[model samples]
Target: MELDDVDWKLLDLLQHDGRMTFTELAKRVSLSAPATTERVRRLEQAGIVTGYAAVVDPQRLGLPIEAIVRVKVRSLDTPRFRERVVALALVRDADHVTGDDCWLLRVVCRSMVELERFVEQAQRYGDTTTSLVFSSHVRNRPLTRAVVEGTAVD
Candidate 1:
């Protein structure tokens, strides 16, 4: 689905506030509620809007610990090596990168005990280290005036 100005505007609004009601989205995009709903529906169908999620504070959830684990897998070409690493729920994100380590996993758990268990399960063929994350600064998607004006974010 080719996105026009309306679609981009909807995305911009939703990016900032995914909880916005369809009626509110309609007003923001200068479209009728039904039209806005249709556009959003199409966007969802086309996979542009994957899904909505509530961004909760890990501290509030009792899972205050956050860390990035560098996993050095012994079996790089093994069939289930990647699969085994990704199966755990604590692993919020995973990526394969070039370097000494084969992959990296971002995990959040309530305590060191939980983290140790998670690590033991995740490290199917690698050594792991759990670092304490004092803080994190995650940048939100830049869907502001710059994107609207098509100046950057290219």
Candidate 2:
């Protein structure tokens, strides 16, 4: 579906706050609640809106340690190693990357001992180099209408 300015605005608002009520969204886009709801449904059907989720704090969840793990896998066992890592619950996100490493994993652990054990298990499949994350400066920035239009807006 071709997205108009209103559709883009709706998407921008939803990206910032997925739980925003249909009435609130309608007010922002100057459309009726039903119209806004239909637009959101169309966005979902078009695969423009994939999913919604709540961002949880790892520290609050008792997982205080966060680390980035770069893994170097043997070419022959890459597929098998990938399946293994994907099944691991501690791995929040994993990416297939270039360079000396084949994959990068973002993981959360409870403590240094827990991280060490996770590393040991991960090393069975590939060589891993891990670095602790101090903080995230920016995250989950919303895409504005200007961004989609290839124009500039603050």
lDDT of 1 by residue, 1-154 (tens): 6778888889888888899999999988889999999999998999988888878777898988888888777774444766666767788878877788777888889989988887787666777766767887764563554665788767
lDDT at 39, model 2: 93
lDDT of 2 by residue, 1-154 (tens): 7888898898889998999999999999999999999999999999999999998998999999999998888888877777777568999998889999988989999999989998887788789999999998876788776776677654
RMSD of each: 3.1, 2.1
After TM-score superposition, the amount by which residue 94's alpha carbon in candidate 1 deviates from its true location, in angstroms, is: 1.7
Q: Worst lDDT window (10 residues) for model 2?
A: 145-154
Q: What's the TM-score of each model vs. the native?
A: 0.79, 0.90
Error of 1 at 66 (Å): 0.6
Write down the TM-score for model 1: 0.79
lDDT of 2 at 141: 81
Q: Which candidate achieves the best TM-score against the true structure? A: 2
